[model samples]
Target: MNLRQKIATGAITLCSSTLVLFLGTWEGNGQNTVYADKLARGLPTVCKGITKHTSPDPVVVGDYWSDERCAEVEHLVIEKGQLALADCLTNQAIEQNTFDALTSHGHNFGMPSTCASRAVGLINAGRIADGCRALAKAPDGSPVWSYVTDAQGKKKFVPGLYARRLKEAELCAK
Candidate 1:
């Protein structure tokens, strides 16, 4: 090859290598990435103790989670929850508090459900206060009637869930 062509090729290779190295280092550090405190608070409350898997279908429960495992799972959930919220927003800019609240709600309720909720509808329609209020309501659009059948088929109100919904609503309002 000609000298000029060889020099250009070398330059291109160097630039590409530098870019790859920079990205790899940045991603490896993970120090700059900041997850929302509200999300962190809400996730552990709803999911309870940590297990290897996040899905409830398999029903894998464990008494303890290593600190590293917990951190990894939290990061994974936050990443997924953020994507879900972003997709639901569809280019709409929202306050950080609202985003964090909705992200947590979505993480708990499943993103599709949250996306299709009346709260989201109201928010999209420019009724922010109404949307926040709607978020505090039960999934069926009723007041927080926090009751569910236990394993023995008895009903009970879960105070934790009720409080979480209230907190989410408050965050949304902010």
Candidate 2:
């Protein structure tokens, strides 16, 4: 059965308990602090996650994500991440660490790409090791390689994404 069907039929249960487990497994590890610092250092622009260039709640000059906002956004990230996994992962059981790592990757990259990713395919095919390895490498033309124009018109790759991907990969391996 499909995920929604499974949920509806009580074959699969996704609830606050699952969310709590996910939250406990996926620590932010001060990612918000790094994100905020990167934003402040760059040109004034608003971003929801790593890739979103614009957001409804735009962070302007002299603005930073408040502690409450940070928490709220992180919660949203985890929720979205879990939803993505639910839709794509066929495996009934997944390692908590793997789930956490994939959640972080999905949070940054979004559902569409994560859903279509080689990592997801391998994981769904029960090739967990291959999937984790595939996830560790950023493919060509990935947003991680995209450039942002600075005030001087010089374009540079977004800060922190590379490191973040590395961390995600490390987490995936565990």
Candidate 3:
């Protein structure tokens, strides 16, 4: 391999590692605290938002996790999420806030859906603020990522999701 190609490969590796780390520390956003599932989804989350979906161990509702345990699980989940999004994330740069925002969104929704979101498109297009805003609301000011369709065949606004999206948008714009 040529020197330039080697350098480029090294740079890409560095960037990918940085992108995987995202906010550096998940606790910076105060999301590391254990949270009981309010939706009765039976998925209580802890450090870096580790839930049953991402946890290797069974995530029980009443289980207590130490800070060390939480951090370990958090790193594991982050790695998993980044791998899941490997092809979806472009070769462009993603700022810390943008990384945090999108990952949180993906955890709440699904990683695949988050990849398909318009926010990802705008972000890849370098319209970062627009992309972040799109996570919370559309141009028409209606909620974008805050509703869930229920078994009753109706869409309902979830206050928790709404708040989380708003927070993500705010952080993403920073």
lDDT tens digits, residue span 31-133, model 2: 3332333433453432234223324355555456655665565565556556667778886545656666676666555667777888888888888776776
- In candidate 3, clashing pairs total 0
Per-residue lDDT, model 1, residue 9, is: 50
User: Where is model 3 more than 4 Å wrong at Cα?
Assistant: 1-36, 44-48, 150-153
Each model's RMSD to truth, in Å?
14.1, 6.3, 5.4
Quick one: ranking by lDDT, best first? 3, 2, 1
Local lDDT at 61 for model 3? 58
Which is the leading candidate under lDDT?
Answer: 3
Off by over 4 Å in 2: 1-56, 138-163
Q: Write the residue-wise lDDT of candidate 1 on 102-164 in tens digits.
A: 666665566787888888888877777778878778456665523445656676666665666
Better of 2 and 3 by TM-score: 3
Better of 1 and 2 by TM-score: 1
